[model samples]
Target: MNLDHLRVQIDSLDSEIVRLLNERINVVLEIGEEKKKAGAEVYVPSRERAVFDKIRSLNSGPLPDEAAHAIYREIMSAALALETEMKIAYLGPEATFTHQAARNKFGVSVDYIATSTIGEVFDCVQNRSADYGVVPVENSTEGAVTHTFDQFATTPLKICAEAYLPISLTLLSDQPSNEVNLIFSKQEVFGQCRSWLTANMPNVKLSPVESTTKAVKLALETPGAAAIASVMASDMYDVDVLAENIQDMQGNTTRFLIIGQEYSAPTGCDKTSIVFGVKHKVGALYDALSVFKTDNINMTKIESRPSRNKAWEYYFFVDIDGHVEQPEVKRALDELQEHCTLMTILGSYPKAEI
Candidate 1:
């Protein structure tokens, strides 16, 4: 065909596409209205899955399957955005790792509130100040964040989602100097970079700081001193990264949780978090765990914390496959509750793929 004819054909196709998209959007608005009438959430994962399935099954076009799904995913996401906005709370003075996780999950368009502490983040969601809370649950190198687990022990909020982000540590310095006298960093940060620090700056004294932000500030004031922090810290402090990804383990990662008041139904791939305490008797703990075995529920993580209210007593925090609303999960929970002195289903959330 001539270039003029090809241009005309392209314009015609564009118009057809635009019309179809408008029709789809109008239908989405009607669906949103129906959901509002029934008091259902705008984010219906099952409905989304069905839409994707139907599209994939019916697709026989020039556009590839992956391309079609990508377009549809964004389309559905836009439809949900039109229905409602999500508010995410995170531990921050801003630009912290928790902020990164929050933004990763909800995107920059979603409202974000940075609370002073992890506990405060939990309160923000519990009080409905925010729709969801994002906080670090565990670090690959340092293990669980006790403060997070403790907050979970007291709060009614549950883990509605989980995510992992590979964390890279860096050394930020104002000017190049070999006279490194002090290294400022969080204790965990220092630990993660121990090998690198030992090899290169063994003479430098380590000073444990409150947070990565604090370390950056302190290092700025102390000449010949460096702050061990994320590369983001250098950007925030107006300093240069002297070294990057200094953690001893190259693959070091942090696991974060999304806490909210609502419980998610099973997404086929789901993770349920729970906290429970055993009765003060032999075999009580065994009985509590056996519920999972009997019900064929797969346990992913189990960590213990000292009960703050009761000396010599411990609470077990567990993460497992399946939502609490699922029959198999419910049965296991019932059995666990019967055998335990105290119990709570923290939250059932879509399992983290990253």
Candidate 2:
């Protein structure tokens, strides 16, 4: 076809695309009204998962799966905004990793609140000031975020969904690499990039700060200072990227949790988290864990934190392979509860795609 003919066809296709998008949104609005009358949640994780899965399966084109997912994410995000004034609270000063994860999951169409601490993120959701909250739960290289786990020990919020964001630390600065004499970042971030810092900037002083986003702000103000943070922060703060992918481990990822008033329904492939305290006796912990083995349930992770209420007492947080509503999982937890001083089901959420 001639160039002018192709151009005309492209314009025609664009017009049709916009028309269909509006039609789809009109139906979404009708569904939203029905949901409101029935008191159903505005955001349903199971429905979101099914939509994404269907998008991937139906995609047969030059466009990549990630690209397709990103497009639909914004579409759903817009629908959610129209349905309600969705607000997401995340740990931040802005451009923080948690903030990025929240945006990645919810898209750019919703409102975002940046809080200084993980606890505040939880409080926002608990008080109904925000529709949902996002907080980092663990890093592949650094292990569990104790603060998040501790919050789960007391909060009434449930883990409705989860997201995995790859951690890519960079050296951001306005000064030349050689002129930089000090670096700033979160303590955990410093540890993640320890080897690179030792080899490249051994003489530079490392300053641990409240967050990477805050560190970027400090770097921008302080002469000869650099910050180890995400590339997104560099762009947001207009700082130069002195180094890229500086984290010690390749493919390092942080797992984040979405907290809400209720957990998601089963999606077959799911994970359930719970916290419990066992009796103070030898083999007590073993006996409690043995219930999973008896029921042939797979335990993915376990971590213990000191129960601040009592001296030397601890609570064990566990992640199991199946949903809490599964028959075997229910039976196992019932038996496991018999061996515990206290037990709480944190939530059952769909396993995040790594």
Candidate 3:
């Protein structure tokens, strides 16, 4: 076809797309009204999942699934803003990995609050100051984030969703790599990029700051300085990415949890997290865990933290492969509760999108 003919066809398609999008928005606004009247959450993960699944099934495309998903993401994001002024709290100074993950899940249309600590993220959701909060729970390479685990012990917030952010730790600096003399990053980030620092900038002074965003800020202020941070930070902080993927290990991804008042209704494919303290005695831990095996449940993760008020007492945090509302999962929890001093079902949430 001639270029002018194709251009005319494209313009006509765009007109139809705009009209259809508006129609979709009007329907979404009606949904928002009903949700508000019923006091239900407007952003339903399972419904969104169904939409994406159906879209993928119907797709016979020159366009890829990821591209289609991105398009719908922004469409839903706009609908969400029209539906409600949802606020997301995250470990921040902005542009940090937690903030990035929050944006990934909640999208950019909603407002975000930057809390100084992971605890504050919990408090914001618990106190109803924020609709949801996001915090890093674990890293693939560095292991469990203890702070997030500890917060579950006291906080009533449930894990509404989970996000897995692949860490591509970059070196952000105003100065070139050769001119850089100092490096700053969060304590955890330093460990992730330890080998890279050892091999490349052995003589440079290493400093640990509160967050990667803070590191970028410091790097921007101080000449001859570099920061280990997300590539997103480089743009937000106006620093150059001196190097990309600097972590010694490959495939470093941090798992973050979305904290909110109530656990989401069961998505057929879901994961449940729980924390419990076993009565300190021989085989107590084993007996508690054995319930999963007996019920034919698959446990995905387990980590422990000191239970604080008592000496040598600990809380065992576990992630299992089914929703708490599921019959098999409920029965397993009932059997598991028999051996614990205290137990709490933290939350059941949709698994992170692959």
> Which is the leading candidate under lDDT?
2
lDDT of 1 by residue, 1-354 (tens): 999999999999999998998888889889889988998766554455567678989999988986887677667656656667767789885656777766665655557898888889988888888878889989999898999999989987767677788888888888684866898988988888788888988889999976777788888999888888777777876898887888999989999987777766677778888999998998989888998999999999999999998899999999988887789998999988998889998888777645
Tell me how far the alpha carbon of residue 146 in candidate 1 is from the true structure, in angstroms, after superposition. 0.6
lDDT of 2 by residue, 244-332 (tens): 99999998999999999999999988999999999999999999999999999999999999998899999999999999899999999
Better of 2 and 3 by lDDT: 2
- Model 2 CA deviation exceeding 4 Å by range: none
lDDT-sorted candidate list, best first: 2, 3, 1
Worst 10 residues of 2 by lDDT: 41-50
Candidates' C-alpha lDDT: 0.82, 0.95, 0.90
User: Candidate 3 on 302-338: residue-level lDDT in tens?
Assistant: 9989978898889999999989889999999999999
lDDT of 1: 0.82
TM-score of each candidate structure, all chains considered together: 0.82, 0.98, 0.97
Per-candidate clashes come to 0, 0, 0
Strongest candidate by TM-score: 2
- In candidate 3, which residue pairs get closer than 3 Å at backbone N, Cα or C atoms, i.e. clash? none
Model 1, runs deviating above 4 Å? 1-35, 42-82, 177-179
How many clashing pairs does model 3 include? 0
